[model samples]
Target: MSGIEELDEDRLGALAHKLDRPLVLIGLMGTGKSTIGRRIAGMLGLDFVDADDEIVHASQRSISEIFDEFGEDYFREGERRVIARLMTENKGVIATGGGAFVNDETRALILKQGIAIWLDCDIDTLVERTSRRNTRPLLKQGGPREILTRLKEERSGAYSRAQVHVVTGDLPHHETAMQVLEALEKWL
Candidate 1:
């Protein structure tokens, strides 16, 4: 199993079967958490959940609307609740919002209930990917590169507490997912 295309299905299945808890992906925005998480869940025969999507569903509003109507504090509180509920209900691949892991309570909950994996990436890649969309709340305040740089610095310590760390580059999503699988193989 040198590469994703050459990976042995039986070996991959065996590795997935060995997992005892949910795999929670924590990272800055544009780190490919949602994209890679879905692939990992499919590979492992588990469910895939995006925390922000769940938050939107629960709130019945867009994240921007939630922020505008309720403020970030309100949104964070709701996010914490939604994550706790998700963590308690199922063992799967959970892609969290960028700020979710930065919150102490949410981070503690994730650590307690799941195997947290930090999908780290360089600032250039983050900026490039994030620039494709203008939906990010944090980026709305400033340039993507500047905002992402500050976020990386501020949240690096929190993200470092994850159980596994997978460095992502400007590669295909499957390649990054394969790296996560390799990290999980070592971690488990």
Candidate 2:
């Protein structure tokens, strides 16, 4: 589909059927991965799984609680394991935690077993979007702008390795979702 208007559910489902691996979204926090993943799943008639939510479910604790209790290294190990398991067990769209794709082991596994899509966003946009939520443990440690900027810079290299890259912005979620769908059309 060229645009949202041209996208029909049947057409989306057809594209989804052509997919052989889980579509993993890699990006910094507040890049609309979860929201857009859900939209993509609904459009494609595929199941949706958020890696962070799955991590929460598997650990029986909030992500903040995990980080606060066990620290980032411990939380990351669990994240890597959780993501690896999700890759094998899930065949739909997976919206990963921001740091998930940045880990060496997790990035390698995702690259091998999943179709990676990098949802890139500007530092300004990230700051604005992330402000809507105060539960981000990383942001709690420092200023959101500085933290997000450093994160976007540090993670860009890993994210660039994704099979497909979509530069997203402050547009409506559906517009971005349609853009992703259109990109996947060319991809799958």
Candidate 3:
């Protein structure tokens, strides 16, 4: 959790006060949105809500199970609703599912009601990170690299509309969060 530079708490407070809406993170999976969002929220003294978790809670099923029981379309509809509700109910950091922002309604809602930050990383890193989990329905059918690569190509257009874009390399999660904090400072 050690970062290269010590974060300035006073600066974080100032930035947090400047926030007008939720900080919504949009990206492909394995981009560290949940982890970095938690760090950023802690640093800013804000709440952290993972939209995926909310979806699971509301549905009473895991994401993969939801996909298995219904389908991607059904899951997406629920995801949009969940994200919209979160936007209205929480003025904090929100980490969205990879495909959530691809939904037109969800994308529009985030762009209008929150500061969207897109986190991206290389395919190799994505494969490695996503390998740790077996819960991703999208990757369940194909090779993770191929699915992830195609996902990036298809979703980059929507994700590119984010207010801020950060590419995370081999940095530690804390450093990646620091980068997001710096980007937010500059954007705000």
Distance from true location, Cα of 39 in model 1, Å: 0.6
**TM-score of predicted structure 3:** 0.96
Worst 10 residues of 3 by lDDT: 1-10
Best prediction by lDDT: 3
- lDDT of each residue in 65-99, candidate 2, tens digit only: 99999999999999999899899998999999999
| Clash numbers, per candidate | 0, 0, 0
Residue 139 Cα positional deviation in candidate 3, in Å, after optimal superposition: 0.2
Please give the lDDT score at residue 159 for candidate 2.
92
Q: Give stretches of model 2 more than 4 Å off.
A: 1-4
**Candidate 1, RMSD to the unseen true structure:** 1.4
Instruction: Kindly report which residue stretches of model 3 are placed more than 4 angstroms away from their true locations once superposed.
Output: 1-7
| 57 Cα displacement, candidate 3 (Å) | 0.7
Clashing pairs in 3: none
How many clashing pairs in candidate 3? 0
- After TM-score superposition, the amount by which residue 41's alpha carbon in candidate 2 deviates from its true location, in angstroms, is 0.4
